[model samples]
Target chain A: MESSEAGLRPPRHRVSPRARAYWAVRASAGWLMPVAAQVIWLAADTARLGPHVAGLVLTAVVAAAHVTVMPQWRYRVHRWEATPEAVYTQSGWFNQERRIAPVSRIQTVDSERGPLEQVFRLANVTVTTASAAGPLKIHGLDRDTAQRLVDELTEGTSADRSDAT
Target chain B: MTERTEWRRLSGRMLVIHPIQELLRAWPVLIGLVFAGTAGGQSSWWSLGGAIAVIAAGMLRWFTTTYRVSAEQVQVRRGLLRRRLLTVPRDRIRTVDVTANLLHRSLGLAKVEVGTGRTDRKDDAVKLDALHVDEATRLRAELLHRTPARRETAREETATPSEVLLAAVPAAWVRYGPFTLTGLVTVGVIAGVAGRAVNEAHLDPGRLGPVSTLLERWEHAGLPAEIAALVAVLVVAVAIASTLGYVLAFYGFRLTRNTLGTLHVTRGLITTRSITIEERRLHGVEISEPLLLRAVRGARCLAITTGLRVGRGAERGGSLLLPPAPRAEAVRVGALVLGPTTPLTAPLTGHGRRAARRRYTRAVGLAALVVAALLVLSWTAGSPAWIWRLSLVLLPVAAFLAWDRARSLGHALIEATLVSRRGTLVRRRSALACEGVIGWNLRRSFFQRRAGLATLVATTAAGRQRIDVQDVPLGEALRLADEALPGLLTPFLDSADS
Candidate 1:
């Protein structure tokens, strides 16, 4: 076995710079859930004076650490490349994934923009095959880039007459 | 049959059956209504109105539903208020299922369910609930047999398509059924339901007639002895129940390959089910051996095709080709089903020493953690010594499992099919057609990367949707992917330097 075939190299392009802020906002929103739950729990059981304050402090520390670290890690990890032959992507900060699907097998290509993504001019491009393992979602991309990718994928998919199954 | 293209209503017998079926469905509500009626006043009026409304709706459904089969497509129109029309192109039809429960059988009716390959939306499931048995058979044959070119000549062709019986095997193979351990799940379910019923009725099971005597005996016999007796009873119960379940589910089980390029499977005792699969849609076959089944050298076979799933964990399917049978029979059937040329019996390539080491580390490491936790708990909480002592037994069991898991991991690309084998407790050897593979997923965990391995998942539309080739060397994974589909990975690969 040769070094060239040793592993899948990283995909070609990184996402937009605004994606970092967008991810930070999204991550902070996720972290808020625990804080909200803790607050409601404390309110429900005001009688429990001993552990609630300590729990709240521990939760804040964990949430803050997560909000601070996750976004930057995700921004660094997320990369995508769309070629005429295939779509290659690398995502996930800890458990990294490299997915490759031939253009012939591509069933659908869609671009979605969340409410917050609109503020950051960021979007997600989803490319799917017939398999239920699910679509390849490239998150936190510039809206224009997402649109172009979708267009290119749609064109590439259409040009091939295979059933894409 | 009525010029082949005319829109037709459901069997007239449905008019009698539908309202009865609907009324039966509303039994609990009907009981509640009856109670309300006993309370007197305007409640009786409300109950009567509700009953009438339900019956009227059921009766109305038969009139609203009408279907037409044409040369190009099958079109169905239903619902009086919504008036939705569903049209499926003739070529897109992947499977045609005809099922008849006891009531439907008694009424000489069958339900026709058509599965088009695009099964992404639940709404796309096209079914006509109650059609005449004869009509249903005719419609199924017409829908599934004819190609677009041959559709016009279907009526003229008097002789039926030739059918080669792949397996008319159920009675002779009945001995293999109990080994499947399928009814263990059913036993658990029955016990759960019984327990729930006892709880709801405020009945103490321990004080029940024979149960009270059994409890007294168990209390005197000690925990281990009591558990051993219970296990013995459960095993006997499960074996008997398993045989019964198998007979009921696979009564007169037959797999037939038709001259028209369709595979037909007809089985089930109480609720008769006949599944017609388009031969072209078939990607592969899976021969699965559950632990107990493997102990007795028994295996079951499922078809890997578009449109239907191979029902996870249930040992039930819309895709089952063979129920629990001898492993040789399963292999033979699997090979025959995949067509004559497939090397389903070909030896697989193992994932080497590193993969085995990884499996051992994960399994044994996890087991050790559990044992350590139990020991720590014994020290901290002053728990019983027996529990932590029992945890020590898990170490050898976990090592055995890891060894089995390592041995089970293998994959091979034979001809145009990619054969992958994995899992220990429920070992599955899946052979998938290369053409059916839609994509490649190279997943490398942080630990897996350090081990120079990747889990290569071949994404397909059939059976579990993805066949995992776990912990293969990165080079081997790339090579397999490249060979599986030539152009898919070649663009991204670097120039090989040995």
Candidate 2:
């Protein structure tokens, strides 16, 4: 109610310790896919080039690079702000591209948590606008922070649909 | 008020007959196969008997199937051996489209197509067949949000009279000129022959060789006379094809809006189709006059409806709100159908306008090159030579470009609404509301930049779809966006940025 009176943006950035635990759980959970694929292929033909060690290593390396690089990328990207009139997202590596869509234009907003993220109490927020272009998704947020942001944006935009469903 | 309306579920016996319906639907394929088999001398008496049995089984299945409806919902259980039941919730239905073929009209039956926007995929919309005319109307009325009405016995026998808001008999002043069905057929024949000749060059290289070899072997062969005969044939073919094409394109084009406010268009011959557009899904209505249509004081109008039927051809995608009507009549019809749209002002002159002219010239140049290529190919091949006639096609393109520029020439920005009309031949006008617009994008491609023109795309909440007006003056586009944005969100644009 207070946030509504202030017209959004009452909460400052809250560091999420739960968000980090979520990343670790997600990284390990994803290992299941490659493990399953390898088991299926190995059972089919025992002598067929054995297990693809190179592919496993490459995937791990890329994933590790992503995990290590994401925080620095996140730090560079400034905080998001959802006002009564618009939802502003400022993101970039260097040049800084700022996207501001009118709050009314925000058709849908989804907050989802994978099994690992659920374990670590982290959630991903996606803001969808009416066009073919992809939604604006921000991951690696603390559970409470994610919830609050969702509540704030949802209330601020006066969206007809609710996240309770 | 007197009619006591009621509905009952379609009979279970009907589903038992479904296999027959499936077989009947495949009758075209079966008939084609039979003709092909008989032509190849493969038909036996047993085969003939088998075909007759299959057709008889299908007819038996169709005759037994029937349905009843109620005020609340429509339930259909149809099939012969295996009955399948389908229950449709009346409230979920978005639009009910009615289609009547000659067979249906004579039989007093109509097909009802119900669109439920609940599906993520639009094509999965439900279509029910062979509803008795009264049943179809009752279903359509029920689908719409309205008070339930009791149907009387007398009302059941009479066909529902649909309210008509717009009508245009094809104008007398409009001449087909070279754009006719006959002309199309003639051109098609010549082109088909030429294409076959060219194909033969690749398919059978030995068929056509040096002229000297032909002359030496066949001294009686009048090569020049043969060539002249081909030319004469091509000229006649093109003329006839053009006439035929024009007739087919403009035949029985009627667009009507029902009192319920749904737009319906019925057109085409041989395989006719009817498309109904729900009022809520419509973005706006556009009225346009192409240079050719303009000369006859006629204009074409279209409605920007959601869920465009892709790969369905021109008639299927957007709602043709009006067949070519007199310019004044088109405006009036558009106003009635679309709810009073703003009129387009005459185009203004400046750097951007000059650039638009240059862009049109570029289009003309590209078409001229294509025409020239076709002419040269015809001359090289033993096909009919008609290069001069081909050059005349470029004239229309030039005229079309100038006229399109003249029409799309201005943009009107009224408070919270923006209306833009653009086109030379097939004109499109789009009216987008400020509240519905999700975002505004100003884009300038290399071509646009060179032409001092820019395009403004207004994205709306209905979809990521945009209303794009190309080759408009850059300053005007920006000014209109600025003005429109303020009305939608108040001074919130600045506060949101802050």
Candidate 3:
């Protein structure tokens, strides 16, 4: 490949095909809830503010908005790559917020899933910060992907800074 | 000083202070009210007699209530009908406070209260209302001595200050006044008039039988001069009683500290209370300048606490160690009592104080408009003549607020404290330590942003105290926030992600 082509090539395309397939599974699993909620609401006939035609129009507009604004789900999120710093999940398009927790700051990792999430094999990762408040949360990752990320962050590379004397 | 490293169970006798016991102790007051009303013919003989009988029964039941204490827990069993057995662990107790009533004080007793940290329902504050002064002190000491390790595994702990600099003990007390003499006199006059009005409004013709009989007896017994003398004596008695009631209800103010860290404050002549603050829980400090006291240059300093409102610190509201002292004296005395942990000074400006005053005026102006609108509506509807004069009351309040606004402008510089003065009814100089700042928010409205002004609100775990410098340079606010963050986070750095 030309030097310019190499520069534009995306960083994670080097991962195995299985890993790419895993990323697709996680992305679709996460989008299922809003899609399901929209479908149910469409058929319920519960619109109170307007005529049925108007209700249908309103519902379509809302559904379209939700689909357009769904958070990016194609990227393969990782804890850290090499230079030794702990990685954190940075999401939320509007706020563009970032949680910078080092591997050392990982007090504990709890993986949880609700009934709906479990049906689609998706899990939630809750990360606690130092103070009692302000815990970071990453939602809607494939079960296996979530486990791998937690293991990579919790057990790999950097020294256990929590045990630093 | 003795080292207290373990939680000790309260004495078994402490259970006599349980709520049921308090209900029992108040039985006499119930009986007294019934007796007084019956003798005054305010109630029927049958109803009065029934109340007396019930009070007697309740007192009898109270004598049977009891409690038990072990090394680790306290259990109390009370109530004759629906009994409750409350068991609380000693280690879980956060604070032990004491309060005194006339009966408790005369008997040399204090109500020992235990604070459980949970806010889900009410605090688990069980009052042992009749513990001896010594017992209450020992119990408080015992609770304070319990080590943090024994309670939880938290790495950070509340440590006591050593090498004491200033402690205000009860012995160094200067008479603290809540209501000035002039204020008290005005209150008495208003109260007397109100009392007479209420009596006339509630009076019944049937209830005048005793008064008629007394008048008739006096008429037959002697000279017209004697009757006139009797009336004069009665009026004088009422006036004296009203004045005395106003003063004593607001009396016995004492503020003191030990050379060590503990501060003891006791006030209220009738219902006395002594509070001991461990100091760490004192999240913020406030010094206020009320409008009336502006010319006198008097201010009151109060501490902000969690859960309880200001001054809920065992000692009634912000234990006023320095009651209405001059500016210099207030600062000196406040710093001494607050100790070295507090910044020696605050950084505020005349401009900031003026801004604060303007804010107060804005609030008062809004109140006046509402009152004026209401009065106009009432007049249009042909309401009472007195309703027209009601709006006039807002005039004095507005003038007072304006005066307060004029006086409210003053700020001082402290290396690590932000001292801001603001108020109308109560002028306060608030001192917030940089160490307690949890987060800071810099907000700029469109106008403010254009004017190069912003508000930096430092939120502590306690509450937010906004420091607004209307024409303040924006760069300064951000720099101040940046400077404040390092000190605030130092204690929590061992665990913070950053």
What C-alpha lDDT, on a 0 to 100 scale, does residue B92 get in candidate 1? 83
Residue by residue across B1-498, what tens digits does model 3's lDDT show?
222323344334443434444455455444445445645755445544666566565454435455555556656555566776667776555445577776566667777666543321333345554567897776676555544355354223324323333323232222323322334455566666655544534544345888688667767867767768777765665545544543443355555553333555555567666655545545556665565455555555555433233334442353355444455655676676555534535445554442444555565777678777778777787767666576778767777666655565444446666655655576666676655544443444444444444455554433222343232344555446546654332222223322
Instruction: For residues B354-398, write the lDDT of model 2, one tens digit per residue.
Output: 555765676677777777777777777744666647566786867
Candidate 3 on A68-153: residue-level lDDT in tens?
Answer: 44333323332212113443343343222223333444455667877766766767676553322334466666778678766765
The local lDDT score (0 to 100) that residue B486 gets in candidate 1 is 84
Question: What lDDT score is found at residue B367 in candidate 3?
Answer: 68
lDDT of 1 by residue, B108-134 (tens): 999999887665365666889889999
True contacts kept of 1: 0.71
Better of 1 and 2 by DockQ: 1
Indicate the residue-level lDDT of B464 in model 1.
80
DockQ of 3: 0.03
Q: How well is each residue in A1-165 modelled by candidate 2, as lDDT tens digits?
A: 222222322123433555544555555567668766866675676675534655556777776775656545544453455657665554433333334466666767789988777776778788877554325566667777789878888886675542110
TM-score per model over all chains: 0.88, 0.57, 0.53
Model 1: DockQ vs. true structure:
0.58
True-vs-predicted CA distance for residue B381, candidate 2, Å: 20
**Candidate whose TM-score is highest:** 1
